[model samples]
Target: MAHYLPTIGFGEWVTTVGEVVHFTGYERPLDTLKLADPRDVKLGHLLGTADMIAQMADRCYLEKCRDRLYPEFVLGGVALPLSANGDRAIKYASGLDLLRQTPEFMMETRKKRLDQTFNQAYRYIEPLFDGTNPYLDAIERSLDFLKQVLRSESWRLLRRNPQVFAAQPDSMTNVRGLMVGYFKKVWSPD
Candidate 1:
């Protein structure tokens, strides 16, 4: 199962602005950071990118983690200590209650965050019920857009319907093995 944390994490250092700038890895040569031109990456944008990535990743991970860690999550395996900057603190709000305290998007109030005729009714909850969420839809659309161009496609479905492949009575085989095992207990005849 995907693990959910109330806290948000970004990229895959998964990452942070700090990690992105000073990253050392088996794939991307670490030694090159010093020599390479950090162009195409502004200092501000790096932080924003890390923050945006963390938020999006955190949001995705939340659902995958199955709400067991609801209202509190850690992105990219990051702790994001309480004392971290606004960029980081926003990354750590365990509850929407403290969303104001979170440093994301300069939002100081939930009212501002949900600025619509019906905040809870329309902006937030409606889409979730109808499978039209901005965050999720964005990810799916982007993936589809990218896959069309990339020669080799690596499709992955966590805990949802699989539309790409042909249906089979043994759809369980398409899911994770552990989930299949769980289903055996709950779905099998007593």
Candidate 2:
């Protein structure tokens, strides 16, 4: 049960903690998202989250990129507002596709324009190193949990953010194996 969402809405969720949210100036989300409600932004942002979306695309490509991808589960069901802590990605499906079609395949497939979506995403996530960045931490934790699931059960993401579930191995076995390595060293160390 995947949610096919468009652009995100604005002011639906508090972007930051202890901050006042003003949607009266709700022009940005209206302008950016197509058929979007600010409330749905959280859902959209969840989809936009790097590991989440990357895994989304990977799930889409599970059969194709299985050897290259890991797996992911569905996102939130109950409508949650967007957080300034949106774990947005650079456009995941596209990025994972790039990974699958690298070394000139995608470049040649497209109009010769460099697709830096994943790189752009990587750049956005650069600020996660030092302190407690909720967004970065979310991805980190999700990845951590994902790795654990991978090592222990070879499962996929059932849900992310507040809820994480592992079911079937969807796609991206290569990525799954990478995650397994992480769990082998990090969480399940014994």
Candidate 3:
């Protein structure tokens, strides 16, 4: 039986069936456990690479950056204390709320988080490709694309109403799909 773990970023479900693991909820199926050589070191690296790309691509990052993270920084036990009944005081609000409250601060916070998370990964992963790996080049391009998007007015609009752009495809997510395809391509029986 496959027991489903709590949904993580991007509504993905991590399921464990005995010793096998599955990733569901992606537009494309990710059956990493069924690789020809399950113990391959490259497999782990590829998965990590894909995961980092997916995280940056996720729309929820904006929401999390504001609703969860910003509050933790701005609100406190004394400034915005918990309820008298001990209930959580910081109720979850939309990204627009954060933007409306402090647009400049929110933009700075998002940029900082992106630098800390995505840029750090890029620095670590860049050398592994040695300038020849197409996957690595693709990742770098995607990272550049994301950085450009972050500076755009569209990103602010995205934060305000993600649903408006829901129908449109995300380039980062496409890059993740490309990474997965490359992983399969590089997986050899030898």
Q: Root-mean-square deviation of each candidate, in angstroms?
A: 17.9, 17.7, 17.2
How displaced is residue 152 in candidate 2, in Å? 35
Better of 1 and 3 by TM-score: 3
Please report the candidate that would top lDDT against the real structure: 3
lDDT digits (tens) for residues 1-190 of candidate 1: 0132213543322323444444212234433343233542334233333443334334343233322222223322222434434333334333232222233332221133223211222233335557555643454453343334233422233233323234666443444443435435533776
**Clash counts for the predictions, in order:** 15, 9, 0
lDDT of 3 at 177: 58
C-alpha TM-scores of all predictions:
0.21, 0.21, 0.26
Per-residue lDDT tens digits for candidate 3, residues 1-190, read 3233433342232332322222211223343344444443233434444564454445454555544444443333322335889644543343344433443443442354324322333345556667454543444554454455555645653343343234546743554455445435434443
lDDT digits (tens) for residues 93-168 of candidate 2: 3323433333233234122211231222333444666543454344345445444644564444433222223365
**Which scores higher on lDDT, 1 or 3?**
3
lDDT of 2 at 187: 35
Give Cα distance to truth, residue 50, candidate 2, Å.
Answer: 1.3
